[model samples]
Target chain A: MGETRLMKGNEAIAEAAIRAGCDAYFGYPITPQSEIIEYLASQEPHKRTGMVLLQAESELGAINMVYGAAGTGKKAMTSSSSPGISLMQEGLSYMAGSELPCLVVNIVRGGPGLGTIQPSQADYFQATKGGGHGDYKLIVLAPASVQEMSDFVPLAFDLAFKYRNPVMILSDGVIGQMMEKVELFDQMPRATEFDQTWVTTGKTADRERNIHSSLDLDPARFEKHNHHLQEKYKKIIENEVRFEKIQCDDADYVLVAYGSSSRICQKTQKLAREKGIKAGLLRPITLFPFPYEEIEKLANHVKGFLAVELSAGQMVEDVELAVGKKTRIEFYGRIGGMIPTPTEILTVLEEKYLGG
Target chain B: MNEEIIIAGFGGQGILSMGSILSYSGIIENREVSWMPSYGPEMRGGTANVTVILSSERISSPIINTYDTAILLNQQSLDKFENSVRPGGLLLYDTNGITRHPERTDISIYQVEAAAEAGKMASTKTFNMIVLGAYLKIKPLVKFENVITGLKKTLPERHHHLIPLNEEGLKRGMEIVKEVQLG
Candidate 1:
């Protein structure tokens, strides 16, 4: 722990990976999240600590490199924004099917196509519901600030390795581009505390082992393998669901927002108080687990709820499932890289609560 | 409980200082805050914007789409962000550059001749200070003592000699605010 120094979100994630004993980094450059690659490029990891850093020809190659490095029980990571992340889905699915542990990051940009340079949470379903083919789930952590971006990378690695599954640090353009204070620590002196019994790190003198591809000729065996994976996912859901609540006590009309949209919710809370409207915000830091229980609790007290997002209607589906139509739950958003102004949000609230 | 703000302008004006003082006041009050600028190709005489977020709680997102309050140092920024002002929000503008009011009736406009006031003080380029003074008078998010303390803390070790003059500029700018108001 040291004095906080200003760093961009992408840079902080890179530093956190180094601290978490991530010896291998394979990535391709993309907007918003480019600083991670830039920071890794500037560091002398090879000379100082034997960390391997490589920029691959494409996102697919980078992901495959992560697969190779993780196979050796080495902490490895690769990062890209939305479109680039889409290209790596095939590799991610393969990694998941093979039960490989590694970290991947998608600093989300406006998307569906190439989109724009601005931020968007449109990739929520893709990340949480599994964008790739076949039944698989990746543990996804959505960071709301640059500090989280830096601090959570090591944690992401810890979870990825602990569960023997892939984990993702889902961020956006705002978190990547903005600079804030972060603390960095030296790399762990002795690594590999987690289980390495399954790793095929060159056959030892006593025994030999082989790593399998995502293939099985026997139907019963493959079904058993997938069933085991589903059990692991069930454990993740039971144990890990993270969210932040503010002034929700005895409040009506709770506002559900995340990432950049959460900032406006904070301001809206302040303004709502001044205008004598009772409102609060529920911000989800971990988007995958979805924080269903917390939203369910708020449904009891609030008369209505608002799902504010950068996209037209994405996370609203999850909210609907959680609330289950007990009250009036509406949504307000701005798509195509346009951000919703606080005033527009306030207008929505006033119309629903105070009557126009 | 202080509010963080970012006022941006053209290259010649004191755009950075507006954000600097707001952040400085937050520091003096022992509040968490930051002032980030648009640099690189964007800062090269083109349109520039800054994002500032201040709160008692941990600030999740620092990106600013609409300012809680804005002090526009030039006409270009005004044209860019006038509609962004919340209904019943404040827009502090330089009357020197903008001869007209913003076309929105929902926001309160406070226009001032910032360049003229700074010029009269022989601090020709310190229009940012003049804008800050005006901001203090109308908004009052930070105290004068805290603002001064933040200014001192911000003074570089090499530029300690310039602190007194900067204080004078800040005080005069705050004083100049009383001369202009919109009803």
Candidate 2:
């Protein structure tokens, strides 16, 4: 309801989390995404409304702290770039196994290891196909704007608790480093109400409570727990797949991309018009739950599709699977801090549609 | 039809606040907007910039490579961006800082002696507002009255005294644009 104001994407997410009644922020600093930690450090959340903001020794420690806070049903989050997110995977899997609800933001950077300071969407497979090990899924929301960066916090929390799962706001260096005006809502009061019947908040009065690790001796109980998680994931897939389409109402080519890469595709759509090519864009807002159904529908209309990204052909695999080889799907990218220019994207469009 | 722009320069030249006011004007018009900034290691006398996207649609991607408009406050920014601007795009430059004329024939370039004009106003930093005023004049995307109202709404509650001076700076900017356009 308020007017927008200039804010860095990292700072905006930090403010949004606090406003959304986050009980704790546990994080370590990492390049391109370190501002989130820096902002929290400056705000000194302990002095303001009892939010515990801790600069952990490592990303590993930070995510485990999130697990502890979330175990008590207190809303909590942690954030880092690719390397840090990689470090936190063990804890993320642990949280998933224990059925703890929390939020994790990965402001992705180019990497197989310490790749560069610039933005890249190479984490697509890591995020969607399971960043962490074992049979589990992280609900990932890819925000392309600073405004959406602020807006996704509450929605992510709602989804996190709705399914008793972790939600990942998968962004990149571009989204984090970029500056934009954001309309910030007044901080809402924390929700203390939930199915406390399952949590361990000191086991107050009526009965003692227990929280345990996912290591089970009995195969039947383990299999049952896995089945329950599988059922939850299935429901998430059925109920939560989300994406956006532009200028695709009647188009022969649909360009599939997400996060920062999708923004480039939007510009490509405009240029494609000038070239007399009917092109559209399919941008996935949620990485997991993948929005397979929508992509399938787009496949029916567009003659060919290309997945453009900062990395070489990561998300293209998903496009091929969704659209099924019926259409020609190719990819174009630049790695290691090299941002793909709009002209480069136009060239790709020309090649695919104009047969150049 | 709100316009989104990025005003980029070295940190000392007031690039941050330049983008800030444009975003402020958009808000006063009751339009949706976002002003995202890059002020990190580059803040200590290195290049800094902010991307302001003001839109009527439910905006998705805030990052833009093809700017509808741009305000280049320094040479580095001009060299970096002058070639990248879209055809028919608007380029507003600081004549006092950038010596080279952009060779592009596709866009309208408005060269203003912003720093010099602001020096006359007794504040070099106010040059940003001058460029902002020029932005308002060329596009008139938001009304002057609304922009003034937005300025009042946006200024910190404690800095009320600076409001009058900022208004003067804005007025100076608009007047200069009119003079340049007429000549």
What docking class should model 2 receive? acceptable
Highest-scoring model, TM-score: 2
TM-score of each: 0.80, 0.86
Best by lDDT: 2
Worst 10 residues of 1 chain A by lDDT: A181-190
Docking class of 1: incorrect
Indicate the residue-level lDDT of A259 in model 2. 82
- Candidate 1: which stretches are off by over 4 Å? A47-49, A183-190, B10-29, B35-46, B54-74, B82-183
- Please, what are the lDDT tens digits per residue for candidate 1 over residues A1-356? 65454566788888777767788999999886888988888776676567888999999899999999888888889999999999999988988998888999998888889988677888888898998998999999988776788778887888888888889888777677766556666567426678987887778777668674788879999999999999999888888888888888867778899877887777787678778888888988788778988898788779988899888788999999999977779898888766766767888888876685
- Residue A175 of model 2: what lDDT? 81
